[model samples]
Target: MVVVGGGQAGLAAGYHLRRQGLDFAVLDADPAPGGSWQHMWDSLHLFSPPEHSSLPGRLMPVQPGETYPDAGHVVDYLSDYEKRYDLPVQHGTRVDAVRRDGDSLVVEADTGTWRARAVISATGRWSRPFLPAVPGRSVFTGRQLHTVNYRCPADFADQRVIVVGGGNSGAQIAADLALDGNVDVTWVTQRPPRFLADDIDGRALFDVANARRRALEDGRSDTGGVASLGDIVAVPPVRAARDAGLLYAKPMFARLTADGVRWVDGSQSGADAVIWCTGFRPALAHLVPLNLRGPRGHIPTDGTRALSEPRLHLLGYGDWTGPASATLIGVGRPARDAAREIAQLR
Candidate 1:
């Protein structure tokens, strides 16, 4: 068996695979164990507390003076978890393709091919940042960047900026910039931003998801989960920004102008830079040779196992793969199930 990626999802899969006593290697494109967490913006924090944001066997150690663990802390936790488990992960091995070879699958990577009875793809989405196509986007002369390129608020100090998208990244980055005071920030969203209740966090959200899943499994009326509450979670910085009236959002602009943007109401605002907090698409380019992608650019799966190919399992893309499987705490159950299923095949 082979698991592609060494992020939280991949590491979770590794833990379960170890318990199954399976022979496997986790191939990570990165040189280290932290995965995508190490690449996030400096101020980024988990939506939940450390205990609720941990991987399979070990709990993430809480950082002093932090209600929510920041990106650096999460990186440390992942690195520690990898070492604690002694999972066989091959760092810096970038898998280029997965192809069927007789009764097994061949994983072709920079480090050479590995033949395995089953392959689990847990690459996640951080590598492929999505930026929507707006009119006159190319003509805008100011600096434009996506969430992946943003590092810290100090980078945009004393400049008029536009933050696009209504998701967590949009709110967080806008709040981060708003706290700087020197940066003139304007948040633009497709619709009015929906902020979840202040008391709600990832733990509550996870419970709601589980409840909804149970309801569906029992053939009862579908009780909604996080989406029913709202879109953005009121993290500390975001709540602070909201309290300070710095998190107000404007309707999305109709098009980009030479210096800034033009709104649907014929209003315009000049800006020095535009930051796109738009989300990401799964990084599944390596699976192209498998010819498994559907019209929606997703490989159809039953639970984590690929629908078209039993030897392939897709993990951590989103709720479609498993309930909240993209999150640290939410991935364990699905990873365990996938590992169990693979073991049965053996």
Candidate 2:
């Protein structure tokens, strides 16, 4: 078997597969072991506490006095997790395609090909960021950046910036930019943003979601107002922004102008730049040749196993793939299930 990614989801799957004593290799496109966390902003921290953000089998080693870990810390943890398990992860190997060859799957990559009995595509969406198409986007003269490219807010000082999207990324980036008093920031969301209570962090939300999922799995109806991962986790920066009255979000703009945005109510605002905190689509273009993708290019799965292609499994693309599978803490269950299913099939 071959696992086509080395992110949190891929690593989780690798752990399960290794424990099951399966002959599998994890293929990662990155040059190093840190996966996407290495590319995040300098100060990006996990919304959940360290205890809640750990991968399967191994607890994340805590720092001397820290409860939450930053992106760099996560990178180190993932790197160490791979080394600790001695998981066969081929870093710097970008999978170009996955096609069927008789009963086996042929994994093509820039490095080399691997013919495996089954394949698990755990590649998350970080590589495929999504930006909404507003009118006059092409004519907009100012710089436009997605959350993937955005780093520190220091670069946008004294500039009129609009941060779009209602998810955690949007709120976090908007808050980060607003903290810099020099930058004038406006947030745009399709709907009113919902910030989880100060006490309710990612851990609580993950627990609620897992409970609901288990209830449903056991044929029970869940009548709970469970929170989605997108709900703001009241991280320090976001909480500070809320207290500072900087957590205001407006309806999305109708279109873009040369210098700024044009609102739906015929109102206009001048802006120097637009920081699109918009989310990402699943990076499954490599699987398109298999013709298993459905509408919205999402591969329908039954508990991580592809519906159309049983030999193919997809983990951690988002809720469609599995409940909270996009998250570090939430990915373990589905990955374990996928690995178990693969082992059973073999």
Candidate 3:
């Protein structure tokens, strides 16, 4: 067996695979552990408490004086988890493609090729940041960057900045900049931002998702999950900014101008930089050789198993693969199921 990532999803799969007593290798492109968490902005934090933000069989240690663990804490925990479990993860092995070789699957990586009875592609979306093709985006002369490139608020100090996107990333980055008191920040969204209640966090969100899943499984009326609550969770910093009236959002811009953006209302604001907090798509380019992608650019799946290729499992992409599977707390269940199913097949 082979897992094609070493992030939270891959680690979770490794844990369960170990329990199943399966021989497997987790191939990670990164030279070290921590996966994509190491690339997040400095102030980025999990929306859940440490306990709720843990992987399977291991609780993330509590960070003293923190309500939510920061990205650095998560990176450290993942590093330790790898060592603790002694999972067979080959770091720095970049998987280039996956294709059929006889009855088994061939994983072709920069390191080498490996044939396995089953392949679990847990490569999450952080690698493929989504940038919408807004008009005049190519002509914008000012510094423009995606969330993947952003590091800290200090990098944009004293600059007139605009943040695009209404998701958690946009809210968090805008709040971080507003708290800095040095950057002139404007936040714009396609629609009004929807924030969850102060009491609701990732734990509540996961419960809601589970409830919805149960309802669907029982053939009852579909109960909505987090979307029914709101798009963004009111994390500490975001709530603070909201309370202080520093997180107001304008309508998305009509287009990018040379110096800044022209709003939908025909008003223009000049900005020295624009940070796109746009989300990401699944990083599944390596599976193209399998020729299983649907018209929507997603592989059809029954749970995590690819519909066309039963030997391939796609984990931790999104709700389509498993409910909230992209999140740290939500990924374990699907990962466990995938490992078990693979074991059964063997």
The per-candidate count of clashes, in order, stands at 0, 0, 0
Following a full C-alpha superposition, what root-mean-square deviation does model 3 have from the true structure? 0.9
- Tens-digit lDDT track for model 2 on 28-51? 999998888999987688878788
Judge candidate 2 against the unseen true structure and give its global Cα lDDT, from 0 to 1.
Answer: 0.89
Computed on alpha carbons, the lDDT of every model, listed in order, comes to 0.94, 0.89, 0.94
Clashing pairs in 2: none
Instruction: Itemize residue pairs with steric clashes in candidate 1.
Output: none
Which window of 10 residues has the lowest lDDT sum in candidate 1?
293-302
TM value for model 2 = 0.96
Writing each residue's lDDT as its tens digit, candidate 1 over 194-220 gives 999999999999999899878887999
Candidates in order, TM-scores: namely: 0.98, 0.96, 0.98
Residue-level lDDT tens digits of model 3 in 154-185: 99978999999999999999999999899999
